[model samples]
Target: MSKSIHKPGFVLGDALDIPTFKVLKQDGTLYKGAQEPEFDKEMALKLYDDLVFIRVLDERMVGAQRQGRIPFYLASLGEEAASVGSAGALKPQDMIFAQYREQGALRHRGFTVDQFMDQCFSNDRDLGKGRQMPIHYGSKALNYNTISSPLGTQIPQAAGYAYGQKLDGLDACTICYFGEGAASEGDFHAGLNMAAVLKCPTIFLCRNNGYAISTPSAEQFSGDGVASRGIGYGIATLRVDGNDLLAVYAATAAARAYALEHNAPVLIEAMSYRLGAHSTSDDPTGYRSKDEEAQWAKKDPILRYKHWLTQKDWWSDEQEKTLYAEHRANILAAMKAAEKRPVPTIDHLITDVYDEPTPHLRQQLKQLKAHMRKYPEQYPKTSGRLDA
Candidate 1:
């Protein structure tokens, strides 16, 4: 039998228009037809508290970077709900493959303020052992993968990890977080295709925050958005207002249920705006206007959630003030302690890769130590204890 060549009738203008799902309004009121998720007063208050804590942390850390206390930092300034809400919906056993800006997810998963400061300072107490740059976090206890600096690398990795989970007969999935800018990478396509083919339980969360560094979304792609691409790959997809906590939480909960029950992948494109500079290294004034930032500031997720909590009488203005004061003091103290700690030991440089250091690496380390000895005065006091 010969293969039949069939071309289905199709029209270019008949493409599907993906809708953005939203629940909470700018004033924190639910839309008339919007259904509230399974959130209760206690959960709502905790989410609100996390949102505020993350905001304060970002503000203080950015100031620290300005003061040269930290080398670099990335703030989730305008996109707290996207990270925290979605993370709140997931089970603790579920793993997270994060890009740098999802610190709120870690915080929601029990990462401490001291741990954040330790990683930022790259001190001996850091779990990553002074390896990663500031803001790149990881916690095995929390099942959050260590963040890599390369964009889109985690997409395919998430698929592979989920496949492993499936093989192990575990009821857990992996959530991969990236920016819209990362959707341009080849790994994005590869990851989605692999997940669809293997039926891996993975959620690809893309934060479509208007700009990729300084490049605007208008210049990034011509398609509807990242959410639309999921249709091409046969994956369940959703587009949500990233600033709306209730909407994000509801959508993520549904996505998790679908992925786990069907053993399939889902993609959530979070429509949001980065209300701060891309990082401490960049200046927002170069590409955005003050008026534009002020406009988004009006939709601040933390304040929006606060309004909802207050309306339910679960929160008060006095509580907000006290929470902010306590967080600020805790962060300041943590930063001071982290800064005073010692850097990773010199021998740690040759560890964690193998049971024994390779001859080439040992030789390199020896040469590095000789060079450091030759230039001891130039090195700082915290530069590793070579003898021990």
Candidate 2:
């Protein structure tokens, strides 16, 4: 029951262009026809505080990495609103599956500064038992899945998880975060297709931040952007200015509602720029020009939101100064504390995989201990200490 064209033809993918949704201007003013999201002062202040916290945390952690305190780090830098703003729109009960850079999302869910530091430093207090690298954060309490190293793995996993949620009759959806580069993975296709076909309540948020660890978006794909791919998968799609906090929040709130109401999938493509180097190990100077970075810097999401708060008489310059100073001191103290804490004991390697350590795992741990004893200098003495 389909109408066909008389001549053989194909839809021109490149001809499709998705408009970027924006609510606030760079100067903190709303666009002529744009509407602000329904955010109360308390919620707004909390989100703003989170933005400041993550910005400060990113700055301090990057410095720590440079100082050889932490092994590696990633900075959200210019894309704060993309993570924090979207998180602000979601309910606490909803599950979140994030790529590494969505620390802002974790922070929004009450992940403490100390928790971040513990994970980054791989300290004993870390919930992950010092297994994950810096920025690989997760919390069962917060409903955030533990981040895995492989890119795009969370996409399909989120789809399946959301289906389970649907079957359970839960009043929540699953939100998955990833970069534009990860969208190129086959997992993205499989996840989107599965969600669409299964009618799972899921939101796939893509931070199209212009690069995937040095490869620019121009080289990554040829379509209009990631949003186009979402449409291709038969999912509702929204494109938003990632630097606009109000825009991101509004769009995500809408996406969540639509997905839950219809028991369907939605895709959000946040257009942003990675102002900082991809990670501590990267140097953007090699792949991008300083001028390009400067242009994006002018659109800093935190500053824009700060201006809007000040305009509404909610925040002031004194408060801004005090906040920056306070967060800086707090993050530094947490980092120092985490640095001094001992790493997880050797037994942790064999634990958490089963109800009890299996015989093979115990043997493996015994072998590891013996290996460490044979070369004490090769490993940290504290890490090798096991209960006798």
Candidate 3:
């Protein structure tokens, strides 16, 4: 007898029309029947403060980059709610693996303005020992993993880390932040599948800002979005208006609860648009029209949240003005201090990699120092300070 089998049919249709979860409207009013997150006044104020600080920091750093203070910079820009709002929903003990844009999350978790400046300037006080590029932030104490420049690499790493958390019986989960563009990589599939199969508690947060550098989302994928991909992998998923802070907080809080209770992974697709260039190196005007940007600017996340706070009697216009002035001065002072600090010593190049430097490594360092001496004038003032 011939071995015959019938293949099941799958239909390609809009069966899963994922709705965007939104609490706060563009006019800053809560939608009827939409419940607010369980956040107190103190937490609400802090979240709003983070949103403002990140915005001001981005504006200042971009100017700094143009002035040749920093080599490269990527701003969170219009996606502050997607970073700080979601971060605020989680406990500090939970691990965060970020794409370079989630600096607001770091700030929300106690990464100070001075610490940010130190890292950006690559000074001696920088946690990365001046090895990584500016904005590649990391903090073990805050449970935020060091950001790697390679895209989508953290997806698999987050799955593995969350699996270890599951085995260790820890009460925390891992949250991985990435762009919709990174979802195009194979690591995304591998990581989500691993988390699904292993039942790891990981929250995959995709900031779908409509562009992966210069490529638009339409050119990147034909699917509904990142949330649909999560459903395909048998993971719980959500799509939210990334500009609405309350919506992000509510969705993330619920997602975290489900992940921890069920020991499963979740995906959150934040639908927001980047209000600035992708980076200092990118000119978004070349690909996106100014009219399109102007349209999104009308839905500014910070303004929307500020309006909400004012409506709740938690903030006022005078307070906003005072806060902005104070933040600008503080940031300016921090940057100046960071610029004056020396860079890490040359010995830091090989110290963190291993417990002890091998013969070959020591030889390489010696060679590097001799080369630096030969080209002393070419090196920066900080680079010449071997004892730094």
Candidate 4:
């Protein structure tokens, strides 16, 4: 079926212009022909609540980090809709593998304010047992995998998990979340190819938020974007306006349905911007301009969604103020309680590794405790229960 061209010819990669799917415009009205998402009052309100919660959580946590209360933090900031909307479309049974910034999705999936505080403070109540840095969240009960610090580790893991779901004949799929930067990693290629060839039901959601911690997308790749690569991998793909909540929800819902029905992988490239620094440590002023930030500010997804809700009479200005005030109080209370709690004891470090601790491991723990005891002045007494 080849064209059988004898002359030497090369095709431009940009020839295929992918259009971004949009439902809600900047002014909070749907495009003339855009079909509204199937969102009920409860669903719409829940998404809005999660968005506000995430925003406030980011602001407070970043402030906490700056005050030296917490070691570090990452904020979804301008990109809240990407995670919240796609997550809203999935069934609770589906597994989620996120790359740090999808706290909105976790919150939407029932993670409480206290739980978030516990993890950030690395208190005894933290699910990760103080092993991971702040913002790396997970919950077994929620089917959310523990986030690993290394980039792209979860992509292939998601593919493998989706294959397992297929073998078990479970009516569920795995949704993997990562930034465009992670797409440059070999794992992204391996994961997508594995899912495609294995016919695993998986959704690879890429938050194309313009930058990978300061590296702009222009330098990250020369192609059309992440979605264009999905086509190269022979996977179904879609590009969506990440700032449009309804557009994200519709695209993800459709992608989920397609992947499950065909037992194939689908990739979604969400075009958005990272309005905050890569982390509390980095200063965005060094790499980006304020004017650019201001331009994106006009397209704030939460504000857009709020406008739509106001139009529907589902939300009001007073409700916005109340939600922010309530969440601020709740988050502050939770943070105080979590920080007051002691960290997990030293024995906790080795307990979960095996059924019974090995002699060498126990020896290491013993040596660690002795080191702490001998240098009590050097180590924080609240680091763990060294007396044990």
Candidate 5:
């Protein structure tokens, strides 16, 4: 009889698996053997500020969606540590392919409040030219790919891009963020296999948010957790406490080193939960209990991290109050202004693809314009940026 050999310390299906490292507890006490981040007081304060800003942004945008100010929104409520911590460990030149919920990464990378509002409002100044639905963000300078609605497509794209980085022999790696729910898709399998075979320098970050829409993680798979899938693909992998920012930062920092040095993909499974609905369109209450939601809320990323900072004598209640107020005011002011701004220029509809608009494209634009003019009252407001 052949006995199955499992790696030492690699526990499958546990909320904590693989590296499963944690630096701080919920009360902000350090677990023995964990090292604190090498952050000065100024930088630490800025990091806390970013968390506050991201929370406010998510909160306001969700309200916008509910009030019909925007068409849709996806809040990254409880998963901020995974998003922000992973992005924090990377150089800005590294690429990111986010699955729509990692806006905290963008916030940490210095994306302007104006820029966010522009996309949400579909304003003329929006970089995407109002083409994407709200929250679909990208910037060439930032090296972030524009968001896509299809699940798991970015997983393979990330592997392919990382393969290019490997061939180019660049120091930069690619980070692709997706939910554990996304790991269930076929593309997730294909991406991992390609990355393993090609030895691409990629960090596949799976935020196991305990739900695929409203369905619980218990309903998603039979195996322990998403971490098992990474080892199955033969890639180096780590699992971390997603609510513990320090743990996430430390793990991702190590993961980056392993990926960059080897030019081989690494998978990180961050155990966390979504404290909000899947989207503005979803209702989690039907499938999840209030007690469950309350339990996850108690493990809030911002709070836990704040407590850690305080434990180190780096933060205070006064500072937290000040940061929250600033973020709230800034979000409200920017959003109101954005909502009143005009939509993207009509000429943009036929530009950007070629030196000159093609005959077929021009024909389509003309037809669209005619339809708009025909129902001037119906199409009164300039149609918010056309989807390319």
Candidate 6:
């Protein structure tokens, strides 16, 4: 039973007709009737290597957190293709605003092992002066905004930054990364609406990883996942297989092109899963069964990429072994060196915030020093920093 219908203001068909974008399948095969996006051998190798590096980073850091070596950690795990692929699509000068778990993006932008470890260890040399938690990576050269802990705060900020970029008349755009968990926040709606109305050049990349902490996606939203919501807000939206790195890269590259040409916003929903616990503080086994976890393990992005790379003669098992060992050794050595580095000096705390420490600010610093001195044994590592 079909009937003619129309809304005066609406032009597109119903939401269900809107396509979900994808390029690869779980068996390391292409879609039956779809053509794969073309990429040269060198570029494909670069993407594959970045995925391997990030997977190693996530694996080792989770172990470090378990051993009480770091305060906290988040795993990108199954979502590597989404972050790395999207970041790979952006120009070096483009800005990146990320929620936690987008470490892959930082690594892709050439953030070093020492830089990552310095942030984790709160070392004096850390760019943020160790103010942020581990995995909250940002780099000035990379133009990646420092990650904020509050959920969805970056969403609206991304829109405003994109607007500013447009005013500057630059071809650059802003890409903000968030999880499905962050999509639940009020700021997500506000950010999308603002970007739409203002026609800001922002790309909202949502890593819909199927869980918000222990809560499953089925329990989180009754509507069709995050994609439908982006369409509702009148933004051009696409959903790609998050594990399919090629698809994500293709989609993001196209989105980047559109945003640059039109100064408009685009929403990308990358459908992936959390291959590890939510964080060091979480226990997924408590809420979800191990069998479910086992299923996702088979779809690991690293393995999928390795299959395709080997199929294309771009990689070998021996090369994979060498690469993993190299990154693992580098990360361990860097972490040890970074941990032993001294904490940020007392003056660094206030220098970046104000022209000079005011009378009241100076007094507060004095009080902080006094407290540290009063409890030297317990605050030994603090070294007069208030945050410690």
Give all TM-scores, in the order shown: 0.96, 0.98, 0.97, 0.98, 0.93, 0.93
Using TM-score as the yardstick, the better of models 3 and 6 is 3
Which tens-of-lDDT digit does each residue in 1-388 have in candidate 2?
7788899888898766789999999888899999989989999999999999999999999999999888899999999999999999999989999999899999999999999999998888999998889999999999999998899999999999999999999999999999999999999999999999999999999999999999999999988989998888889999999999999999999999999999999999999999999999999899999999998899899999988998899999899999999999999899889999888887888778999999999999989888888777788645446653
Question: What C-alpha lDDT values do all the predictions have?
Answer: 0.91, 0.93, 0.94, 0.94, 0.87, 0.87
| Candidate that beats the other on lDDT, 3 or 5, i.e. the better one | 3
What is the per-residue lDDT of model 5 for residues 224-284, given as tens digits with 9 covering 90 to 100?
A: 6888888888999888899888888888888889999988999998999999889999998
Candidate 6: 10-residue stretch with minimal lDDT: 7-16
TM-score of structure candidate 6 = 0.93
Tens-digit per-residue lDDT, 92-117, candidate 4: 99999999899999999999999999
For candidate 1, write residues 1-388 as lDDT tens digits.
8466688755352277889999988887889999888878888878887888899999999999999988899999999999999999999999999999999999999999999999999988999989889999999999999999999999999999999998899989999999999999999999999999999999999999999999999899988889888888999999999999898999889999999999999999999999999999999899999999999999998888888888888888899889999999999999999999998877778888899999999998889888888888877763557655
Clashes of 6: 0
Q: What lDDT score goes with residue 101 in model 1? A: 91
lDDT by residue (1-388, candidate 3, tens digit) is 8466688656474569999999998777899999989989999999989999999999999999999999999998899999999999999889999999999999999999999999999988999999999899999999999999999999999999999999999999999999999999999999999999999999999999999999999999888988999999999999999999999999999999999999999999999999999999999999999999999999999999998998899999899999999999999999999999988888899987888998899999889888888888887774657654
RMSD per candidate (Å) reads: 2.4, 1.2, 2.7, 1.2, 3.7, 3.3
Model 1, residue 360: what's the lDDT? 94
lDDT of 5 at 3: 65
C-alpha lDDT of candidate 3 relative to the true structure: 0.94
Clashing pairs in 6: none
Comparing 1 with 5 on lDDT, the higher-scoring candidate is 1
Give residue 94's lDDT in candidate 3 (0 to 100): 97
lDDT of 5 at 57: 95
Local distance difference test, candidate 1: 0.91
Q: After TM-score superposition, what is the CA distance of residue 108 in candidate 1 from its true location, in Å?
A: 0.4
Clashing pairs in 4: none
Per model, state how many residue pairs clash: 0, 0, 0, 0, 1, 0
Candidate 6 lDDT over residue span 1-388, tens digit each: 7467775555443446656677777666778776666678887888887888888888888889889999899988888999888988999879999999888888889998888889988889899987778877778888999998889999999999999999999989999999998999999999999999999999999999999999899898877788888888989899888888888999999999999998999999998989888988898889888898899889888788778778777889899899999999999999889988888877676676888778888887888788778888987776545554
Q: Model 5's lDDT to the true fold? A: 0.87
